[model samples]
Target: MSTPESCIVAGQLAELGHTSLYDLLEQACREYADKPAFSCGADSVSFTALRSHADCFARYLRHEAGLQPGDRLAIQLPNLLQYVVAIFGALKAGLVIVNTNPQYTAPETRHQFADSGARAVVVLDKLVPLVRSIQPQTQIERLIVTSLDDWRQPQEQGDAADETRFMAALAIGRTLPEIETGRGLDDLAVLQYTGGTTGVSKGAMLTHRNLLSNVLQAVSIIKPGEVEYGNEVRVSPLPLYHIFAFTANCLASVFTGFNSVLITNPRDLDGMIADMQRHSITLFTGINSLFVSLMAHPQFDSIDFSRLKWVNSGGAPLNLSVAQRWFERTGSVVREGFGMTETSPVVVASTGNTPYKEGFIGQAVIDTEMKIVDDQGQELPAGEPGELLIRGPQVMQGYWQRPEATAETFTEDGWLKTGDIGVIDEDGFLKLVDRKKDMILVSGFNVYPNDVEDAVMRHRGIRECVAVGVPDERKGEAIKLFVSLHDQNLTEADIIAHCREQLTGYKVPSYIEIRDDLPKSTVGKLLRRVLRDEARAQVQP
Candidate 1:
């Protein structure tokens, strides 16, 4: 499946003539000049205005801020109209955007700023206090602060000691002359940090070519005639800082001309529903947990999904029950996909044409290649579960400043070693088994947490659950299950009894903790490492 010529064809799918995201943005502005590029709350920007604003900001970076090509600029904001402007503006200045999560704590924020050597940060006003404290500790020299309401009304320029307000920067930027960056494809564009699920967070270095290719790859999955460019509204609830949303929603919108409705706070289900009601949403992207949370909302049935054409699930495993409930209620199948931050996020996805099947992640997109390999690095036969390795243009150059890690992650042949175990069928469809690191050993038996969790999710009373391996005396390691429930009446014994019917004795949880909540990442992916750490700490030495 992975031939040199096929790879060339895949890269060509993006029409490299556009070269970089900056080129694509320029083309989008020209082609869809008057179209709504992005909307958040009451503010919306047309492609023409977006280009003008971006140009102004780019000028500010070059002349006022003295930022040059390849300089790292951190953007710490929610899904606001300003976020879109800052992205294009930074790109125009040839700045590498370090997408920092707005909710990041002081330590997390400091580490990213320090690690990436960010010279400037565009942060939300509320989060400025944290950034203020961490600024002196890092190389950050400029602070461009913005508020949620800043887009609605331009704030008067502030003479703050160490910062420039966002509106003020744009106002100042508008007067500066545009600087030709001469930056394009193959140049690093973003430093997307991994979730640090395994250990410390590291930035995945993504170039323009990597992201652009993934954008084309994602758009290609729609197939021709499925979408009407410039006539679609995408309801994007995922955080833009996440690579999944960065490529699939933000970057893809540039190429497809779809107006993206940025959901600033997806947790506010009522507000999200209101946004959905306001826009005739044609595309929706979310993780499995978000889908479940939305379905459980009190006014879920009140929202109109009649215009919804496609619903995509990624970032985590899609539970069969959640997917089924979504289809039954919304009449849209929840097509699942698999991606990693290192791959500019989208490696494989289930398209609209794919049949609805449990655990099916569909096939690799136009230019990507995937193979299953055993512990010895030998390729596994079709239908055999093993570690999944990927090779594609979308794959990142490497982790930033972590040469040892980057070296360890790639094979001598150039395939990226994805720690997740998966099986590919003869027909090319893929099914994820579990993370290789998350695999549990129970008295000489190999137990995958996904299998155990999938079985437990089958019970009608369960809302969400995660399985982790804990140190066991007799068994090498035992499964520990943590769950949040729909029916509070269901006890730990009931879950165990139910799992017993579906899984073998060793696969059943040795202990069940019925909690009101479970630890989750910002994206709503359950943090098995957090639970595992807690479980191990409780065990006696």
Candidate 2:
């Protein structure tokens, strides 16, 4: 058995020069003034113009909206140019950004706004009614709404007492004097909320140091792979609200100067493909399910993938079958990485030069330290899977306004309890097992869902699959697998027979169900919790 010191691993450290996100943005604007920074559909904005617009919005927030420094501002919208403007503007005004998912329900939206104590909200016009229904219940005093095409034309203020169009705010802001925001690295930058798969979503209090360090760490790892500064075009299909995209795509762009093509509706395969053809993208960021869906598109093969340098897979586990299919089609190996909303999101990643490995998730990223520990909080040796603990500059300060929850999430020595089960090899490569909470016990034997799901997905007929444990009288818990198949002729018996080849007796699924499509999040991560609840309900009655 190895000691704790032998088990701990650290990545090469990277230095962060910028004090805050504002400082980084200003530097990018100065260096890449005329370069295109972002594009949505047919519209594009240069770095200089982006800075001008952000300044205008920041002035309006300070002067007209009466939002003071350190105020909480909830930004609820999809992937749009307006999102970039709003986020940068909020940072410049010294406001803490509360990124809200456009796909969230009214209740979910209200909880975030109310919990964060947000005083103002910038929401999509289409979802205005949902916000209005719950606005009175929240602390939101100022309302800023935007439409899909609002950036193209002037917009009028709404009839509501405090409702102002997003365009109108920028317009009003341009007339005000430049306001100085006295913010630093220690100040809170964003209130990034968790997925709430376990319970109520808690906002992870991310500081400027936390986020900026991550961007630098990512740049240090990626630049050595020959990714040019200020030259590459990154196709960003993931939502910016998710931390995976927030830091990796948006914040990282300020430093790398990559022109990001925002795909508002990734579900629109035709539109996404058209944009791919138009941008000649060099970098791509997406999840496993999306890779499968994109390859399934008939026109997918038509796009030229020669310029594609990197295809990053995060937000979900990377399936070996899907990764191979992507590599075969695009001639680019999928660089798998792991992160969460808490760590400013980039703890470990496979660099551009790293060779493709089936189940390996690379190593701890720059300045990050990682170790595996047992339930007793004692460190585990190499090859032994346990809860992964992380300590890094990118780790969040704490959960917002929840001391008890925050204390429970961290150890006394300050390592963030990642709640993920992973194994670290002697070479420091990590293979994620599954979420600690999702582990199943079958007659005193531990069975990981990822082991079963990965085995099930290898079958040629299976399209997508999720494994969850359900209650059983005989075994205490039984494995239940849900799958969507490419071939309708394949039977549950076939899947069972296939699993029997790779998985142990207790690990093999006891129940199998065929479905047309499984529940998935907006980012295309399989909603195992949702399916688990449904499966458990069915078994109960």
Top lDDT hit:
2
Clash tally, candidates in order: 0, 0
Per-residue C-alpha lDDT of model 2 across residues 1-541, encoded as one tens digit per residue: 0112211121221233465688777888878888999999999998889999999999999899999889999999999999999999999999999998776666668889999999999999989888888988899998898999987875876758899999988888988999987688778999998743344568999988788878877776674757888999999998898898999889998778999999999879899999999988899998765787899999999999999998888876666777788999989988888887888898888976555455789988767889999999999999999999998888888889988888888898888987889999988889887666676655434466776787788799999999998866435568899999999999999999998775556678999999999999999999999999899899941
Q: Model 1: runs farther than 4 Å from truth?
A: 1-16, 195-198, 438-541
Kindly report which residue pairs in candidate 1 clash with one another.
Answer: none
In order of appearance, the predictions have TM-scores of: 0.81, 0.80
Any idea what lDDT model 1 has? 0.83
Question: Residue 33 deviation, candidate 2, in Å?
Answer: 1.1
Model 1 lDDT tens row, 81-108: 8898899999989999999978666766
Overall lDDT per candidate, in order of appearance? 0.83, 0.83
Q: Evaluate model 2: give its TM-score.
A: 0.80
